[model samples]
Target: MANIKSAKKRILVNRTKAERNKAIKSGVKTAVKKVNAAIEANDKAAAASALVAATTTIDKAASKGVYHKNTASRKVSRLAQAVNKMA
Candidate 1:
């Protein structure tokens, strides 16, 4: 649909970025789910480990612009609090 060369290039680039963002978001969701599942199981040790992995994944996603820094921080904080409360 893009007739201009530059526009065509931009379309391709945008498509690639969209795919990358989608993958990152999916990974973040999976990480968060793992933490939640561990918490629900009442396994403090598992929850703690999951939290660490989730935190790292979230921070990386934020750094890569997949998520806002404050949003990522808030998620990490909530997950940490849940894990702490389980102890």
Candidate 2:
């Protein structure tokens, strides 16, 4: 599909980057879900731990450009709020 050599190289590079980004996004989603599940189960300690993990993952994703900085901050803030409310 890519005719030019440069285009072909770009395609390869993009594919690699896409896979990496997908993994990071998946990690972020999983962490967030874990936090939400803990919160729903009324396990404050678990929720707090999950919140820390999720926030760390989200910050990492944002720093790596997998997510927008403001979006990551908002998510972390909301998650923290939810966890805090569990007490």
Candidate 3:
């Protein structure tokens, strides 16, 4: 649909970026789920470990621009709180 060469290149670049962002987003969700699962199972040790992993993943995602900084901080904070409550 892009007749201009620059427009076509931009479209291609955007598609690649979208795919990468999608993968990062999926990873973020998986990490969060791991933490939640650990919490629900009442495994304090596992939850703490998962929380650490989730926080790292979220921080990376935010740094990569897949998630907003505030959103990532909020998620990490809530996950940490949940893990703490299990203690």
- Model 3 worst lDDT window (10 residues): 78-87
TM-score per candidate, chains pooled:
0.96, 0.96, 0.96
Candidate 2 residues lying further than 4 Å off, grouped into runs, are none
Give all candidate RMSDs, comma-separated. 0.8, 0.7, 0.8
Per-residue lDDT value at 81 in model 1: 89
The whole-model lDDT of each prediction reads: 0.95, 0.95, 0.95
Error of 2 at 28 (Å): 0.3
lDDT of 2 at 21: 99
- Candidate 3: pairs in clash: none
Estimate, for each residue in 19-81, the C-alpha lDDT of model 2 and write its tens digit.
Answer: 999999999999999999999999998998889899999999999999999999999999999
| lDDT per residue (tens digit) for residues 1-87 in model 3 | 989999999999999999999999999999999999999999999998898899999999999999999999999999998888885
Off by over 4 Å in 3: none
Over 4-82, each residue of candidate 1 has an lDDT whose tens digit, in order, gives: 9999999999999999999999999999999999999998999989999999999999999999999999999999988
Clashing pairs in 1: none
**How well does candidate 3 score on lDDT at residue 66?**
95
